[model samples]
Target: MTSTERSDTDRQGLSYYPWWLDNLADDATLEGAAMNGTARGAEAVRTIVAKARELYEFQDFSYADVFGDNGFLEIYDSSIQGEPLKVVVTVTRNAAGQAQDLAVLHRPRNSLLLFSRLMHEKCAGTPLAAHFLSDDSKA
Candidate 1:
């Protein structure tokens, strides 16, 4: 599909299945402002994303568009625990159109910390927990 068409679809809101979900490369990586380090592998990325989404009370995308040949960007406003949160997500795909890298940036340090702490709590006892702040840290 063309860039314009993709943008239009994005504006309409993400579908039940986002394009990148099934198209992630086996070695895809996820990194973000709230994460302590990058999470690698498609399964790990999927798990991390699912957990993160579960924490969001709501999300409203302000901008979602394609950039260059294999780059997609999404900027959205969301809330977690009734606090306002803004997120910028960028995905980079391989030549075959499989997502290779997914990066998320969360704004407002307080919100980020809250989100990170929540993530840490939820991911505890799992390998994903290491990618988030330790429970001992101040949220």
Candidate 2:
């Protein structure tokens, strides 16, 4: 699809987290034609996808409530393995569903490399995260 068509859907059908993932995916590919900034982007996306899937996996699934009120999830990027990481990602959901809020449980300083951290704040209908805009650090 063209850029205009892509933007049209951006307003509907998908939420911010999934949309960001999509963009990162494009950055990883040759279609966009960019020669840089995508090598690690693609790896980060795949790691994130795997992390999200683990939530529902029958085996190796935590099932235990990791984050009581803040959405939390982790992505282990093998793309830039051994390199330190320093970026922060927050995935929040307004709809009532299984995958609702995504929060940043912990942050790494000097190094952005964090394969995983405590993630998942509220289930779709639980609404216990305090509108997502809440400051978990203070709470």
Candidate 3:
């Protein structure tokens, strides 16, 4: 669910913490901890989410009717397990040729960052998953 779904309101102040999460008083971003209670590795999920947001924003998927072209995956999610989700985004050309397709995969519950970048690279056939992930144009 979106972060908003988990927030609450109280007499003293606004509570953004979701009852499902641990250490409610602690911020997840501190010490580089992840929402799933994992250490540095948890950052991986944040990485994915960041990627998804990039895609959504770049494509102008902010409105409710827009329904961003991005998709999500939830691997080993606290709410589920062993889910490998994938999504593809398409960019049609105005050059009279068929529209091009780009895959954007989200590993189960990942934030859709690293893997999506890899998938986009693979779709573009730019040495994805092999090299040049950080620098797509270099390879």
Q: Candidate 2 versus the native: TM-score?
A: 0.21
lDDT of every predicted structure (CA atoms): 0.83, 0.29, 0.27
Which digits, one per residue and each the tens of the lDDT, describe model 1 over residues 22-64? 7889999999999988999999998888888888776667667
Which lDDT tens digits does candidate 3 get at residues 1-139? 3334433332111322212122111222211111112212223323433433333312211111112343121111111122233333222221322222222323343533343344344335322223213334332
Off by over 4 Å in 2: 1-80, 83-97, 113-139
User: Lowest lDDT 10-mer window, candidate 3?
Assistant: 57-66
lDDT of 3 at 49: 34
- lDDT, model 1, position 53: 83
Judging by TM-score against the true structure, name the best candidate: 1
Clashes of 2: 13
Residue 8 in candidate 1, Cα distance off native in Å: 16
Positional deviation of residue 132's Cα in model 1 after best superposition, in angstroms: 0.6
lDDT of 2 by residue, 72-114 (tens): 3333221123433322234432333233333332224312212
TM-score of each: 0.86, 0.21, 0.21
